[model samples]
Target: MTHLLYGDRLHLRPCQIDDLDFLHKLWNDPDIRRFLFDDRIISREEAQSFVDLSIKSFKSGYGLWLFFERQSDLVAGFAGLLDFSQEAPSLIFGTNPLLWGRDYATEAASVVLRYAFDTLKRDRVIADVDEPNAASIRVLEKLGMSPARRTIVNERPLLYYEIRDRVGN
Candidate 1:
């Protein structure tokens, strides 16, 4: 399991089978659902299947990690890298509503971006945010990612943002 630290407010760890309930609850939230996964309501079985798939994928160094609030030790949400294409890998993040506006997403994403660039030694990281998700756009900007392209995914228009690690200062 990989553990990522982000100051004293939040940390990220691997998502375990025990986290299924939390994932179900979070995914059921209308607001949260609207911004992700095509605003669709998912069944428990679907959630389980997703977790199972992610667990398998994690073995290959690509999958989501559970976000946690350090003080409360609660699952805040999830963040990780996704294989968007063989040539371009993207970073993705989702935080519990209770932690929204708290910078948890930004903090965790910053750590993930650093890991992608430093540990994974990736040259760049990209993100596809729904056009209506202004807050996420702000977070991307704050992470130093700029708009790279815009495309439609699953019938939804998405803005693609990217950040590249410069070789030398």
Candidate 2:
């Protein structure tokens, strides 16, 4: 069983203690945070704690991982299955704004979706997107996820989407 996923243009590895600074910068970037966390900036200490949890999640054999460009080895995005003991795993993804429209997010997400359904044997995976995030909503749709409902989360309207194992096995 491969722990890390490799794609034509990118690779993924579990977050490490060394990744604290990267996550810190990622979560705080104005362009990234605006959509990822509603522009709320996190302190370095909070970033440290997040990395610690990521490490713990990695130790569990599954969790969030960082995406890196294969050639430059630069962190391009973050994605993975967020179990959270939910009925099914939650799909999460974020990519650098500078690299937008290159299909990196979709490709990385395809890899994670395969891992979740085929490798992890998950029956389904779900994603919750803010209604205004048309780009993300399109990504999920391109991944074959169907919008299931509309609801409010954190006082923001969201659209829920889900995709089942293609074979339904």
Candidate 3:
């Protein structure tokens, strides 16, 4: 059975193949696509590929999770530790634009980070945001992630951030 994760206001489950349509549409939303996929439209095939990867990653103890409002069951967003097998697993998250400023991103991400550091025994995680993505930068900062470095991706200025598991053994 797929595991479910919960936050104070959101409940999350491993994204399934059936969710590809929702994910594709959410990712392709003009307000959202710019912060991810280098602002390119996410094709259904690519979304399917990502769901496939999430399924595989679950076996290894980390992957993508789609979150929903606990009371209304409204599908809010997603959060996950991507590239888990790498030396530094990176964090990824997004919410419907209508849900912005509601702390859904932060709450969902907090659950993923706990799973990463506590359940997966990871030491640190990284995230990169387009320089203009102030909302995401704020979410990472609220999670106590600090600026690590800067780089360019697809000619877009990106700022990377990192957070170590301070509660490490």
Candidate 4:
């Protein structure tokens, strides 16, 4: 069950229970969790639940997927269009801290965005970034996602960005 989303340097695949350890390690990294989990530590139980949910995303024909560098075979990170049980799906993305500043997020994001629009037939996709995550904001903007609004998410200020399918298809 190798689900692959190929990019120039990434091999995006469906995440599985076996990936809990990797998810735990990456999700707990201080640098990544700072912006990702709102600076809160995710217990193993929580990470397990998260993986379970991602696994379930397959039923909907869309969900989070883990990706690796095509040639290097190194874990690039996870990126996905999570419905998050909301009215509209949101873009969730990340890369290994060691790979930061390499446009991997931007590249992975673009791949997911196309999947959302072209394959999933979504008219738009959105991302919610913590106010202080300037880097994440930049990546969303680089993908042509515009700031849609701001609000209190999880008791913290967050900037919500949105990218609509230009052709209205």
Best by TM-score: 3
Task: Decide which is better by TM-score, 1 or 2.
Answer: 2
lDDT, model 4, position 12: 87
The positional error of residue 39 in candidate 4, measured at the CA in angstroms, is 1.0
RMSD to the true structure for each prediction, in A, is 2.1, 1.7, 1.3, 1.5
Measured by lDDT, the strongest candidate is: 3
Clashing pairs for model 3 are none
Candidate 2: residue 21 Cα off by (Å): 0.6
lDDT string for model 2 (25-133, tens) is 9889997777677669989998788677666666555677889899999889888877655688788888988888988889899998988777778789999888899
- What's the CA error at residue 84 for candidate 4, in Å? 2.6
State the displacement of the C-alpha of residue 78, model 1, in Å, after optimal TM-score superposition: 1.3
> Tens digits of per-residue lDDT for model 3 on 37-156?
877898899999999998998898878899999999999999998894456988999999998889999999999998888878889999988999999999999999999999887888
Give a tens-digit lDDT track for model 1, residues 84-153. 6776678888888877888888888888887777666788878889999998899999999999889888
Q: What TM-scores do the predictions have?
A: 0.89, 0.91, 0.96, 0.94
For candidate 2, give the lDDT of residue 84. 55
Q: Scored by Cα lDDT, where does model 1 land?
A: 0.81
Model 4: per-residue Cα lDDT over 73-167, one tens digit each = 88888999877646678999998999998898888889888877887788989888999999999999999999989999888899999999997
Worst 10 residues of 2 by lDDT: 53-62
